[model samples]
Target: MARLNLWRWGVFGLAGLYFLVPLAASVVFTVDVPGQGLTVDAYTQIVGTGGFGSSLLLSLELALATIAVVLLLMVPAMVALRLGAPKLRPVVEVVCSLPLVVPPIAFVAGIVTVLKWGPEHLSRTPLFQTFVAIQNPDFPVVLVLAYVVMALPFVYRALDAGLRAIDVPTLVEAARSCGASWPQALVQAVLPNLRGALLNASFLTLALVLGEFTVAQLLGFRPFAVWIVNVSGSQAQLSVAVSVMSLLVTWLLLLVLAGFGGRSRTTSRG
Candidate 1:
């Protein structure tokens, strides 16, 4: 037992170093200047930096939109598949997981082709406006669409695990017997049980949007990740500083989410 405990601690120490060493190095790089012993100028300048605020705000907006849209589409579909057509569940799972198999470069290339095609061929038609509107750089609804695709596998897995853990049909039937509609049952009964899964999916989608570079960069849109890279060319310290701060912020958000989820679960139980 003592030998096993020692080995577990050793493994944990190694894993902690593996993740923490790089983060420590980045912190040093940001704060430790050659002549100057330590300074926080890098962190201080983040807000004043060009495009920093807008890019971060844009990324948050994209993440929120992605979470809402993906949940709105996926939750109902998954529930229906589980209840009405269990056999089709595998087919739906495969379709959702296709994004994982597809390379980002290929995915972005396809998007680029479609965008170009819309303007070239569909010009002078009502659908042309539809294409033009989605590409608006201010919000770039196209990126939200792309993110929804990229997020499918994670969202599906989270929701599926949640659904499998709970008896969906039984819950729905009970709710229906009590004079609740399908939507009402889902909203009041089904979603409460799915609290944890929903949080996981939302957090994963947010992380993906914040960290993703290829799709946003290729689409010629400037979000937080691209702005960080752009900042690196001019101010390396500030870039690393931004990266560290973003990491901390993400961790803080996760903790808050976890706390909120826990409280909700406790309240539901009570």
Candidate 2:
């Protein structure tokens, strides 16, 4: 037992070093300006940086939109597949997983093509406004649509796993027998059980949107990730500093998510 414990700690320490070393190096790079020795200008300047706040805000908005839309579209479809048509679950799963097979570069290319085609081919029709509206730089609906597709597989898997763990049909049936309508049963009994799954799906979608640069950059929109790259050319140290902070934030969120999921599992077991 002592030997096993030592081995466990050794592997953990190694893994920690592997992650921490690069981050430490990045921190040093950001603060240790050649002759300045150590300064925090890089970190401090982040707030004043021209596009930093707007880009971060835009990314957060996109993340929120992506999470809400994906969950709304996926949760009911998955529940129905669970309670009504079990065999169709596989088909839906395949459809969701299709995004993983498509490369990001190709995906952006297709989006670009569609955007170009809409202006040229559909310019005369009123529906052309539909295309124009979606591409609005202030809040691009097009990005949300793309993110929903990208997030489908993760959302499906999380929800599916959650459903499999509990007896969905029994819960819904009990709710129905107790005089609850479909919407009420779903809102009350079903979603409560799916709390952890919903959180997981939301976090995954949030991460995808915040980290995604290809689609946003290709579409000429400057969200958080692209802003990081854009500033790198001029403010290298500040860029690194921002990168470190964002990574720390992401890790913090993951830890919080893990704790939430762990509690849900514990409660379910109890």
Candidate 3:
């Protein structure tokens, strides 16, 4: 027992060092200057920076939109498949997982080609306005679409695991027997049982959108991640501070999500 305890402590210490070391270095680098021992100037400067507010708000909006779109698209489809056609789940799963195999650059390239071709082909028609509206800089529908595709794999897996854990057919039947419509059955019966899965999916999608850079940058939208990169060129310390702040935000979000999810699981199990 003594040896086992010692081994556990040793493993934990190593794991802590692995994560904490880099965070410590980042803290030092952000605040430490040649002559200044310690200063909050780097952190303080973040607020004054232009584009910080707009970029962060834009990313937050995109994240919310992505979560909404993913949930609306996935939840009903998953429930329908589970209850109506189990065999089709595999086919749907493969489609959702395609995002994992496709490189972001390639995916974005296809999107660019489609967007470019749309106007050229659909020019002089009302359809061109539809294409133009999607690429609007203030609220880029293109980014939301790309984010939904990128997030599909994670969202599907989360929801799939939750569905597997619950007996969907039984629950839906019970709800229907009680005079509920299919939509109401899903809302009142199925979704309550999927609280944890919903939180997990939303958290992953939010984090992915928050940290995603490649797609947004390549497509010419200056989101939170792209803004960080752009600021890095001009204000190195402030950029590092922003990175640390973003990391803290991610951690805070995860903790809150886990808290709610864990409580839901515990209550349900009880």
Model 2 lDDT per residue over 1-270, tens place: 999999999999999999989999999999899988889999999999998889888888998899889999999999999889998977898999999999888998999998998889988999899998998888999999999999998998899889988999999999999999999999888998898789889888888898999999999999999999999998788889999988876778778877877787788778
Q: On residues 1-270, what C-alpha lDDT tens digit does candidate 1 reach at each position?
A: 999999999999999999999999999999999999899998999989999889989998999999999999999999999899999988999999999999999999999999999888989889999998998989999999999999999999999999999999999999999999989999998999899899999989989998889999999999999999988998889999999998987788778878988898888788
Residue clash pairs of candidate 1: none
Measured against the true structure, the TM-scores of the candidates, in listed sequence, are 0.97, 0.93, 0.94
lDDT of 3: 0.93
Winner on TM-score between 1 and 2 is 1
Give the whole-model CA lDDT for all candidates, comma-separated. 0.94, 0.90, 0.93
Clashes of each: 0, 0, 0
Candidate 1: regions farther than 4 A off? 266-270
Highest TM-score against the true fold, candidate: 1
TM-score of 3: 0.94
Better of 2 and 3 by TM-score: 3
**TM-score of candidate 1 to 2 decimals:** 0.97
Error of 2 at 169 (Å): 0.4
| Tens digits of lDDT, candidate 3, 17-134 | 9999999999999999769889989988888999988998999899999999999999999999998999999899999999999999999999999989999999999999999998
- Residue 168, candidate 3: alpha-carbon lDDT: 99
